[model samples]
Target: MGIVRLIDRQGNRHELQALEGWRVMEILRDWGMFVPPRCGGSGQCGMCHVKVAEDWSGKVLPPGELEAKVLPLLPGRGETSRLSCQILWSETLDGLTVALP
Candidate 1:
């Protein structure tokens, strides 16, 4: 298991235990966080947008072609924007931090 620190829209911080091999969106949703992954984990919807902490951005894999295309269309996206549904969690991501937009 790894730790994912999530910052909600309200600016509240939540430390969640992440299971390896799970999508970040799944971990957030399972913890009762508000990531409306309308397209499930397919990267078709930009609803699960999150801004990864700058320092941690390089730690995760880059978005795939489909995700890259969709990310730019999302509102409030930034340089480190990513779809939680497209991010696969792993032990190497322990302590990864992201903020909900």
Candidate 2:
């Protein structure tokens, strides 16, 4: 398992315990964060957008083809923008930090 820290739009910080191989969105939703998995983690909806913290951005897995197609369409997308539903938890991301965009 790993720790995933999230900052909401209002600047509220939340930390969640995430299991390996689980999607980031799954962990966030399980913790009752405000992430809207409108597409049920299928990467069809852009509601699960989150920006990886700069320090850990480089460590995050690269976006897949589906995410690449959807992320740019969302408002406020940045270099660190990612679809949480598509991010798998891993030891390398133990202290990962992300913020709702």
Candidate 3:
């Protein structure tokens, strides 16, 4: 298992241990965090967009398909943007910190 930290726009932090290979968005919806699953966890919706401050987790970024479509529609879209449904958690991501926009 790996630890993932999610911070809201207000600077609130939420930390959880995620299973390896599960995408970041999967954890959010599975744990029923505040994430609004407008498309039922589908990669099409940009509602689950979050900011990855540092992703040393070695989590392979999902293919350009989902991100290419979702990132631009969201509020915070810098270098680190993985459609919550697209990111898979890895052991290296134990201390990963992300800010939800």
Tens digit per residue, CA lDDT, model 3, 3-99: 8887866787888879998878888767667666688667788887876775442455545776687777777677776677767678867767876
C-alpha lDDT of candidate 1 relative to the true structure: 0.92
The residue pairs that clash in candidate 3, if any, are 23-87, 25-84, 57-92, 57-93
lDDT of 2 at 87: 89
How do the predictions measure up, each by TM-score? 0.96, 0.94, 0.78
Summarize candidate 2's per-residue lDDT along 5-94 as a digit string, tens digits: 999999989889999999999999998897568799999998999999999888987999999999989999999999999889999899
Q: Rank the candidates by lDDT, best first.
A: 1, 2, 3
Poorest 10 consecutive residues of model 1 by lDDT?
34-43
lDDT for residue 56 in candidate 1, whole number 0-100: 94
Pairs with backbone N, CA or C atoms under 3 Å apart (clashes), candidate 1: none
- Report the lDDT of model 1 for residue 81: 98
Model 1: CA > 4 A from native: none
Best by TM-score: 1
Q: Which ten residues in a row have the lowest lDDT in candidate 3?
A: 54-63
